[model samples]
Target chain A: MTRNAPPPADSGAVRSAGSSGSGSSGAGRPGFLWAVPAAVFFGLFAIVPLIMVAVLSFASWDGLSDPEFTGLDNWRTLLDDPVMIKSLWLSVLLTVLGVAVQTPLSILLGVWAAGHQRNRAVLSAIYFVPLLLSIAAVSVLWRAVLDPNLGVPAHATWLFGDGNLFGTQATAIGVLVFVSTWQFTPLHTLIYQGAARAVPPVLYQAAQIDGAGRVRQFFHITLPQLRNSIITSVILMVVGGLTTFDTVLILTQGGPGSDTTISAYYMYQKAFKSFDYGAASAIALLLVLVSTVISLIVVRLSGYDKMRSTMEGL
Target chain B: MRKSRPNHLAGFGSLVWLLVVGLPLYVMLVATFQSRPDYAANGPLAFPEHFTLDNYVNDLNSGFAQYFLNTVIVTVCVVGIVVLLVPPLAYTIVRSRGRATTTVFRLFLLGLAIPSQAVIVPMFFVISEAGLYDNLIGVILPTAAFAMPVCALILTGVMRDITPDLYEAMTVDGASPRRVFFQLVLPLSRSGVSTIVVFSALQAWNGFLFPLVLTQSVETKVITLGLYDFQTERGVDTPGLLAAVVLSMLPILIVYLFARRALVQGLMGVGGK
Candidate 1:
């Protein structure tokens, strides 16, 4: 993974002096012009809209009208909006729950799949099927599979008990978290599988020689060795969970009320549904802030930022 | 050096997980092949009394074919844009010493943090403002943009592995940047290019929120949006709905079967996206 690769040694200073002409020592190096097209395109769609989100958060606009600067009104409304508060809470709760549920499960499954056994290979292949499905497809499939009257719940009454799973807040949120877990665990398992395979067999061998049990070896050696992958997987889960929109839309529509309306969905509702673009922008900004802070913390902790120069080493 | 103890606990757990994973899939497949009346009568877990292809036939006739085409167009265009732009940009990031190139790389790093959902409000405005609203171009542009950061990161990683000695040899032979790019860089980064192709294609194919918000007409609707509308419009038609769900994944499943390694590597790279 790029995250663990050493920062590329800075050879730019030595090469830049001769980079002025095509036939210079740096003649083989592509110039900054090569990056301009992608940068401009990304800036237009991503960066420019990000700036517009910030500006619009402070302004009032419907999809039809011109945005008018309203000072702090949108921000003030969001601060007071109970649903906004609840949505933030729900986002956090779901994200944390996703990480908690998926981490250990994926870690175990990943390490298990890392084994070279043929059955492990077959089982892992089956395990990976869910990852191939889109969120919409998965949510739609689960919705049918778990339908209260016509689906699994109808037949498995002993387990589902009326099967109005999406009718209540707790069950609705549970469905969201579970569907996300079911859909995403395989990807994380793949990550951990790769990481686990890369763990030195010597470490596990030494631990075995010391009479460490399988569980003990997993705890002391495997767990520690998987630290970086854990961080990478957790970060992906956090971001994916935070911006979880499709599953919510397909499965519950954040519903039975605003019960499952996490921030992302709520923002969607505010802008597109209610046409409150200003308020939606505010929520969008908040989502960005939260994700950015979380990403920065993880990147800093994992020294991912240091890997930014990975290209320089080439 | 290995313990010979059969791990009953893990075996049990794995079987349980297999059931959890496999059961729904079985239900989906069975439902897709059964008529609605047959499905409702048999329940999701039941074996089909009479297998039929009507559900799939009905879904395809009901505009799923168009949705699939739209999705393919979006996927191909997104992949094309990513392929055309990203390699050169990644090449620049890997080989250039210019300060501006470094800035460009960092910009993509920041791009990683900007989820499409976050800027969607303004994205709606921007697309509409550009007169691309409700057009496939509207969906295509932003989807490609969002796919770029991850594609750039992956390709750059692949390019960086080209060993400086290889570039030095090419340079000593009086190869220009273009010559080396074609002869050495492009060929060596084949895996990375394929990975990005798979990555960006998946993004465009599976994209929902962008199409959900941007395009409304059936003509522009992608498969994901088509499925969403299918679920919302006819939620009770389990067989038809599941068939559409199955259809939505069929292309990727085909890709997965033929290029499992590349597809898996591509999905793992999506951790960044």
Candidate 2:
């Protein structure tokens, strides 16, 4: 590999020049060539495909023929399609519900786990187990456990009713949200746990000295201190929720109808099941736009982009 | 630490959450060890009448062994590609003052926001046109590419923590960039290397969307996809289905048991993903 290439011929001369002026432009620095391989590789698989997605959004293809440019036909049809509109709403609903549910729950768990007690350590370790399972595995496990006949629903009919949870719209959506929260809250909790542990103790001491109790200290000190982590965790949840597919595929199959078919799963159906590559490309582009806009807005509002430089300073 | 009180409220809450997290896990485990008839008769939450390993045995006797092999190959290849490519890239992003290098860093930052689902449509076309569709190579390439931005971000963060004085000392010793990289940068960033290896390995091992879209044959089926097929194909066989689910996560569970700290750190780094 080029990583082991010999130093430039002037290296001895540059060394003799000494380290007094070893600034950003020093001769010891690697060239742009070092970044080429990753850049090209990422470009081929991520960037190029992204561009092709944009172009394909304007063309029609069915995986069996060449794509032909169709202008805004796909977009027009999507604009009028009720399922597309509903899918967008469902995506937003799931994302918002995910953030709403996971944020506070993980925050509480994270702060509680930040304690150094022996029992807390053991409990936190158990909480971390769900993070080990893949999303597909988690979904499959939940599906079987929630089966109306042989699973928990049969025994616990008081809480679950007839247990046709997947047969209705509300329960199906509830299951999607709950399953996601179950699988992902641990990751977010870990994030908040790290952040909570990093909160300086002197601040809490000052709060206590000022007659603030535990709850007050949490709101005044802990919540304010965890601002950046809150942003990061929420962004991850939103993106994960928007693009959630495997769980939906395994759990509900977007079912009872198109009730649980969020935009990401809908896009898969459009392209693969219906073979409407053009329409799916449009939905894909919409998803990219929605996530980017939301991410940028969050970054702008919270100054997260500026936080990157502060992290660089570390 | 503020040991102001026993915090009985928080303890109770934790126990409640423990049940929420633990109950399904208990069900999955117990069901996997029970015969199907026992499971059907007693329900998911009931104690098993007799323990059995038939579920796991049946799953392995089926196609799971092949899926495990395929997932292993994908994971190793993805991790290998990431290890080979990302260090050099992160090293450059840290050390190189070139304008292009900054652009490359920004590119990855932008890449961070582009989810893989957004490009699956064109990715299928591109992979097929390249004659790689329905091949493990098809899944490997895209998965590795998507994993790079996060790995680059993490490794660069780690490398950036190596102070300027260290780099200057190496420069003062007349070391070339390559020498400095191998001796100082690589050794100093050992934790970061392991973090990326664990991170990318998990991503490759558990990846679903790419394999779901790009590949079709049973030959290239990864564990996640195989589990999905099991659910759709033999969903009613709860024990067998849950056993496959357990099988899909076994390797990661072993890693977690042995290297809990490292795995936790690696997963925390996935916050950037």
The best candidate in terms of DockQ: 2
Per-candidate Cα lDDT values, in order, are 0.86, 0.86
Weakest lDDT window of 10 consecutive positions for candidate 1 chain B: B264-273
Per-residue lDDT tens digits for candidate 2, residues A13-65, read 43333233335437576766667888999999999999988998999888788
Q: lDDT tens digits, residues B1-273, model 1?
A: 555577788888889999999999999998898888888887888888897999988999999999999999999999988988898889888777777877888889888889999999889888998999999999999999999988998887788788878887888887767667778998999999999999889889999889988999989999999888988999899899989998899999898888888788777665532
What tens digits encode model 1's per-residue C-alpha lDDT throughout A189-283? Answer: 99889888999989988887898999999999999988888888998899889999988888898898888899999999998889999999999
Kindly state the number of residue pairs that clash in model 1. Answer: 0
**Backbone clashes under 3 angstroms, per model:** 0, 0
Interface RMSD, candidates in the order listed: 4.5, 3.6
**True-vs-predicted CA distance for residue A146, candidate 2, Å:** 0.3
Q: Candidate 2 on B1-273: residue-level lDDT in tens? A: 456979999999999999999999999999999998989988898877898999999998899999999999999999999998899899878866556667788788778789998999899888998999999999999999999988997888788788877887887777777788888999999999988988889899999999998999999999999998988888899999888988888899888778787678777765632
TM-scores of chain A across the candidates, in order, are 0.90, 0.88
